[model samples]
Target: MGRVNTGPSDPTAPDHHEQGNPVTERVVAELVERSNTLGSDPRNTNFAGGNTSAAGTRTDPVTGGPVELLWVKGSGGDLGTLTEDGLAVLRLDRLRALVDVYPGEDREDEMVAAFDHCLFGKGGAAPSIDTAMHGLVRAAHVDHLHPDSGIALATAADGERLTRECFGDRVVWVPWRRPGFQLGLDIARIAEENPGAIGAVLGGHGITTWGATSQECQDHSLEVIRTAERFIAEHGRPEPFGPALEGYEPLPEEERRARAAALAPTVRGLASTDRAQVGHFTDTEEILDFLARAEHPRLAALGTSCPDHFLRTKVRPLVLDLPATAPLEQVVERLGELHVRYREDYRRYYEEHADADSPPMRGADPAVVLVPGVGMFTFGKDAKTARVAGEFYVNAVNVMRGAEALSTYRPIDESEKFRIEYWSLEEAKLRRQPAPKSLATRVAFVTGGASGIGRAVAERLAGEGACVVVADLDAEQAEKAAAEIGSADTAVGVACDVSDARAVTRALEQAALAFGGVDLVVNNAGLSISKPLLETTERDWDLQHDVMAKGSFLVSREAARMMTTQGMGGDIVYIASKNAVFAGPKNIAYSSVKADQAHQVRLLAAELGEHGIRVNGVNPDGVVRGSGIFAGGWGAQRAAVYGVEEKDLGAFYAKRTILGREVLPEHVANAVHVLTSGELSHTTGLLVPVDGGVAAAFLR
Candidate 1:
């Protein structure tokens, strides 16, 4: 292998000099462009794992004196969507001084404090722990990342020699060392010794490349990755392992999704804590292929691809069996035992490696879960974090494959992993996160959530920190609603016709799978028909009953079943109608079914009370906007009956109510939220009227 110039020759890549001040424009712009390009690709970086920096001169705010400044990626920031404010600026001289005076003991804490203290101005973000290392390099720009290709070679036993063979003297090699002031000093020493080297590969960690300009820095990083890829392709190639499932036929798409949904709750329950949001991931080809490997269980337990991955993925993944045909009860029992063993193993691992100074590990729960037959599942405090963990593990699998193909897969030892895992700096990043919202760890499922009252409820629940599954008759609308309710991996969209029992069951499965389990369910899907008793056709009556009455029964039944299996008490809120309590002229079909649905809630509450499940109903009237019924010409029909114009119908209902306030979709959502929030924990089997105080609808 030989060093080859693979600089920015692609015409399609975005130019970095498009925006910013003249002084730092090229450097800053190039950093942003390259960072986004690298960060956007999961193979390059996951979440906020990578760091980049640029050196420039800025006037000192305190003394108005010209000072050299290093802008480094800030802590807890994502590079793909980074902005100017995301980079923390520090005086280069102050950072270098810490290198000379800082004691090695408690280096992590001291370096973090020193970084915070050396901020160029008030309110500046904290620089990454690698900031000092970025300053030591003489280049105008620096890029540090944990790309899969680089990690594959970095974790190999002969990685150092191979790196030298690939790039000759173009890149330096740094032995594994815990990241802190000492690591920074070591990197500086290597760079000084090899003045001609443009980059350095840190064994068992990652790679760093620097240059006089942003373009050169990015080019060198890309070149390093290319050389590693080429070397792996030629020398270290794995024999063909055959197709992922050579003997077994793949499950149909629908069946696969259904199986995932059924098994998701078990993973979620095992991974969750009292205070964590705990989002889940179970559908990906990479995960399936990894699971299909004959040595999957052993290979997955080897370790993470790199040390930085230990912070998110842990030392090894927790492997479990999830056959598609496994009984739910059996699956639950096995998962319970697996969880216990996993925790014990984690405890033992920590005990064996921990020093007297190490802080007690917070929790021993597994972040990545490998389900042999079904696929892989990753858990996090929220959807985005869970997805990030999944991404890292997927990349880990690829890196491991590459390493095994070339040579024995060799990662940092457990002691080194413990150092990074329990490092105060990494832990502080998590600590600095703001307190979670009220419904942080809760999961909710909402039917008809694509729009109207359902959509409002979904959004409100998500805002309060619940992972939500938006189910509707329209798949496109459901997906859109889920996207709008976005918090990476937290919300999912499923097309579900509530009246269909199979569809309802599938939707519930999806809810369980995506969020580990469902805590709150909103039965808000229904249609309205206005017809006199004498004029009502059998089809009209059946359609109304199937949806409002039978639909509620099916959804509630499935939700209760899952909740029962989870052994956790949950809330079920049914969206009934004010007309259910008060008779409305020419509305027999809609009103009668709604009344039946309301009574069903009381019956369910009575039956489920023993299981600690609460069933309640919300009676909302005259929700003119954001209502499917209203948008489907019900507003005009109701207005005609009242001898008012279509546009005036909303006002007409408002005047008829005792409070004379407009009843909106949001008003209904607030009532649903209250019931699901367990604020009225002691109360159940009741209906809350959210119709601006309708007298007849009031509970007697």
Candidate 2:
């Protein structure tokens, strides 16, 4: 098993990563542990959704005087992976003092800039917008969390009355307000007025709890959340979402997934109209349950109440109009019209609320789409984002269930959602994100990707930010190769016999669901039987042609069909060999199939040009070391033909080349990247040789 290396800076054991003094060190250690424990479970917090802090005294380096500091979760850091480095340590005295000169809620965005001056010496990380909430709360330790159970009570129509009934005076209730310096000050006042209260439910938001000690704070946080969950279970009404729609019930597991796969490209295409997007399909029980309910459409239209959620999931989802049991073709036919209607509705919403100072509409495309029988499909610029958005929506569904069980589910209105979605502060945060890699929004499929040249090609494309699907005849090895490359969001492995038309279609379906659709493909699956025409059996010729020439043809045809559905131009590259043009002894079958593959590249390029699909080829020579074809016994046979040992064949072949240099799998992979990099957009029917200067194999 592989292990992730953790060191001094890592806070796995509180003592390993310490602070200025024993007191400060102990507090910091507990803060990190509490944050990680709470963050690990989705029940406590969503990814990067909550904030935690510990207030303590630290020795000032220059003055040698005791200074009050606040160590809080910082911008863009997840609580599950919270380390000392992810915390922003600032002078509490300075941060609190800013309230005296505060310019009010209208100019609250300026207060974030002022936070820089409050850093205690060198700040650990940039303080998040929630810093004020943590700093101003009257306690040694504080937590601001968005637990589904807590949010349910927070967003209920009779939330204040229900909160009083649930916890009595232990947890008070605060009304809705956009988080800022003013909200922080407001929470501080509420805490002071209620001496018996341990926390407060922030209406239309989440929960906030505090304690004089770290353990007390965490215990209080969990107690509040657990109590809320139990209260809902005991007192909540049955069938809160209303009864299931008869024809919209979830389908069987296998059929559900198949339909999800079939519809992925069309849904992804509609979602990516403004810009290319990666998709995630979710079919959890809760998702299906919500979709089947009659009240879901009405609730989904109102959107999520929590700021953390709608920011990732968008203001609302695009619910499918047709029934879940509708035929695949029928659903596909109606999608275009449905997408246009959603776009127009979004445009009207923007125009109705946008002012002269508001930023231009970012996108009209829907980020989430609901399919009753199938599931939910969410889109983002990359896979991780898409997956997280889906998770947030699930949290929203749970909240709605609990809220509706208690009373009417009344979330925040559209005006507030609009203000937060297009907030100037939010825009600045987006601008700060790092630029995307060349193939950031692209997905690639590599044949024979379990080993050798195909594996190299898969790794190369993945490094450039393309989601990769490794397809090979060996199912086990294909999955292993994918795991080594990255997580499921970045890569997946599938077993495929490229020459079989049905198998090829199934593989394409997998790709469509895994990542909206394919943007690039490399046809590199092949094997060689080194024998003269007279000595070669019919089986040898058939195997070579089936895997190389015919296999490339089938994969290309299927990929092209899916790409056309996506309405996105794509790339198809064939890893042909130099022997396609050069004749050599005892290589009749291998060379003939390569020649067939080379011709297919030209044929497809001419035919696919109208669709903006670029078909190209990379021809390599003497890939002896680290080659799957050679490892399968071709190396020994080729050595015998040249009167040399198996290991010496590589050196012999290299010495004969014009440049006397060896060619490796990576060199061929580089040529594929060059062709599909979008730099040579107009270049097709082109073959680049990675043969170390082979004059005989050179294209005329």
Top-lDDT structure, candidate number: 2
Poorly placed runs, candidate 2 (over 4 Å): 1-20
TM-score of each: 0.91, 0.96
TM-score (C-alpha) between model 2 and the true structure: 0.96
Residues forming the 10-long window of minimal summed lDDT in candidate 1: 1-10
lDDT of 1 at 380: 77
| lDDT for position 549 in model 2 | 88
Clashes of each: 2, 0
Each model's lDDT: 0.78, 0.89
lDDT of 2 by residue, 1-700 (tens): 1111111111232322224567668888999999999888888888989899998776676776756778999988898999989999888778878877788788988999998889876748898888888887768889999999999999999999999999999999999988777778778888878979999899999999998878899999999999999999999999999998988899999999989988998999899999999998999999999999999999999889899999998889999877888988989888888899999999998998899988889999999999889999999989999999999999999999999999989999888998989988888999899899888989999999999999999999999999999999998999999999999999999999998989988888888888878989999999988998799999999998999988999999999988888888899999998998999888999999999999999999999988889999999997998899899999999999999999898898899898898888888889999999888998999989898888999898
Candidate 1: deviation at residue 10, Å? 27
Tens-digit lDDT track for model 1 on 95-114?
Answer: 76675567764544687788
RMSD of each: 5.0, 5.5
